[model samples]
Target: MKPTFIILSFFFFGMVLHLHAQSKVDSLTYYYGVVNQPKSNIQLAKAYNFFTKQKEQSIKRKDIEKAVFHLRLLASIEKKMGLLSDSEISSVEALRLLDGMTNPEMIKENRIGIYNHLGIVYRSLDNFSKALEFYSKSLELVEDEASKATLLNNIGNLYLDKNEYSRALVYFEEAYEKSPRLDLKMKARVLDNLGLAQAKLTLPGALSNLLEALSLRKTIDYIPGVITSYGHLSDYYLDKGDRETAQDYAQKALEQAKQLNNPQYLESTLATLVLLNGTPEVVQYKKLRDSLEKASVRAKDNFEYYRYQFSEQQRLFEESEFKRQKLFLTLILVILVFVAIYVVGRVKHNKEKLLKVYETETRISKKVHDEVANDMYQIMAKLQANNETEEVLDHLEAVYRKTRDISKEHSEIDVEGNFSETLMELLKGFNNDEVRVIVQSISKVDWRHFSNLQKTTIYRVLQELMVNMRKHSRASYVVLKFEQKGKSMAIQYTDNGVGTAIYKKGGLQNTENRMKSIKGSITFESNNDAGFKASIRI
Candidate 1:
């Protein structure tokens, strides 16, 4: 029973490789043929070396399809050599490469192939549940009839290994029905499996199907399929109480297994021959089985070591990438902080420069008013007392008034006092009998929130506007309106004067600059025969 089942398992694996090989191209096809059917360990080792180098080159070039192609062939070779654990690792690596790939067709095809290969690998490892899981996954991805038939056959083989002959027959029958889509070699393999499953259940017609499968295999010269057919025929005859006929078939299986040069097939055929011809062959079968089992154990251990090394390298690479990203963020944050500091310092420097210039102008104006204007006032009084020319006295009076106006324009105001009252006084200074000045909503504004720089800017800007209006505007009435909107204070000034088209010069430009220095804004609007208007906001 053991020898017959072993032969069945061997051919099932052969069928799996044969189906998988149909899709290979060019260099991959050449390597697969060499590795899959190696005549010696040295030949397999050379093929392994070539595939490893090709896989590495493909990975370096970012060619995912080519890398996975090499991995699939390498897994087939590893499983053929009884390195079940290594085969499992290779198949999983190939699947990992397909993960998150944008190409859906490529992902589906490669994943189906790897999943089917993993099912075969796990079955060889005696992990029946894992084998079923992979087989089901492969089945889900298979869109083609040939691939579905192949998976069904593999599933049937799994049930056969568990001795569930009835359940195995169901899958085998379905696979056989699907065989028209498969090639002649695959059809022979599926028919052979179907016959074996039926023979295990002692079903009728099993003998005719087995003979037919053998005849099909012979037409194609498939040696592995012929050996499997002979082994199954032997088991069927023995089950029916025909010892002599079974022995004849066992001898034929042993001859073919030897010619094939596969140690596993030879050992299994010897086990069958021992059952028929006793004693002599028992020792050889046990010795060969023990040697193969030890080699399989060593292969599993080597695969575990390789897997551990791969995991460690992956861990180190992720840790390095995480640190690199962290460092980059830290650098960006530092640069942003430096930029904020530079901007604040530049604004502070400009504000200080503006304040210094204002103070200097105030000092010079005070000097001119105290000495030069007072001297002119005393000269005018002396000319009046001495009865000098009336024209000279009038000229002295005009000069004194001009000097006082300059002193008042540059004078610093007491912002700590009633600033609204100070602002109104400054605005009303332009009023006379010919021109009337109106100040509106002056007390409505809350002046406590304003800084000294802001107060000085507002005072200077309004003074410049009034001086410009009084000097050039031949207007009868002037209006100054103040209001608070949101977080800002706004002042609007208008006059029914002959408005000039030319603006943004002399005192008006100076007014614009002063408003800007304190982060405020002022706009002038005028046209011929239209009223002059100035709007200020801070």
Candidate 2:
């Protein structure tokens, strides 16, 4: 009939009722009924095994609600069996599951239950500070009047155990006054506890409240409540120096304890009887207390073993998860790096192939100019010497000039030496009576900073642009401006010609490809109202 025993009894009763109300599955309902039954130690062990297996299976299936539910029940059973450490472990595990749940209402309700359960477990373990901590946490989350009343009563009992009678009375008073009146069983608990706190402080109304609680417990036929009320009444009378009445209540408590077949209740009742009866009862009480103390020591040892094993397992799982995530990220990074390298190598190979084609075209142009053009010149000279017609000689001479121009367009130049002078000479070649070509800032560029391939690309792109302008623009004046900006070079080409819509084709497309090969860029702008313009950046 201790406060701790009453609290635990109330907890199990509520838990069983809750499980019965919520469960729809037949198997689950059967197990709930089996666990709640007052049976032998063997039956209780079987119930524990069933819930443990259910919890494990639920976790494996990732059924969070079922897992948490089983864990909470497991904690309650463990606490009932006096395995305080195991109960603490079970309650904490349930709370861990609740942390990841997305349902707010479910999480809040389950958290309050688990916190309250942990408080009880800690209190049994004699960890008073930890008990208060969990109790405060549960109080913070509880909203319903019934839950508030229950928690307030439990807190009052805790303070009572600590001998803080005034503080216990305050909590008990508040619990009794809370809205939505408690049920007969809960009301009796609160009233009984309130009376005890008052009696401890020698306050008024203690006897009336105690009698009322006893009357309510008898009305409900709740044996545990009746036993607790009797025990409290005995203590109350004993405190007031009424040995005869105290002895009478203690005898009644002892009879109820024997009928209940609960060692804790029997042991407590025997201790009280020993206080009233003296000598012979004292030796019997001492033996029972020693046996209970030895059992408690074994339970404590078992708790320590379970706690160490649980902590070790948890640590190992977290370490394994950390390593797995790190390895996964490392694999992803390696794949990305290889992909980037392959793409870069492919682009480099294509650019080299393009540059090789350009070099081959230059060689073919030099061959055509040196061999076929020389043969045509010799043929024209022979025709003039043989006195052929003037028209024939003129036609042959035109063919020679076309061949020479083709050679000039694809001719190779010294891009690595005096690049600026070579570039200027190439631009000057486009000058004629029909058009005036002007160049600016050509000497300002640091030509040596550019690679051979980059210089070649620039030269070829410019040659193509000039050819396009000459053939299509019909411009009277052209200006090519070069400028250096930071580490890059820029070119602006403008022509005051009858402007036309810009199209990407023929020589213009070739120019774009050439610039792209060297990782440079070009843009063209033109309209009927404005002269043609191009901007190049490298």
Worst 10 residues of 2 by lDDT: 300-309
Query: Candidate 2: lDDT of 512?
Result: 86
TM-scores for all candidates? Answer: 0.50, 0.51
Residue lDDT tens for model 2, 46-94: 7788889999999999999989999998887787676777777788778
The regions of model 2 sitting more than 4 angstroms off are 1-46, 279-538
Give candidate 1's root-mean-square deviation (CA, Å): 19.3
Candidate 1 Cα misplacement greater than 4 A, ranges:
1-29, 35-43, 279-538
Predicted structure 1, TM vs. truth: 0.50
- lDDT by residue for model 1 over 136-199, one digit each (tens)? 9999988888999999999999999899999999998998998888988889888888988889
Of candidate 1, the 10-residue stretch with the lowest lDDT total is 300-309
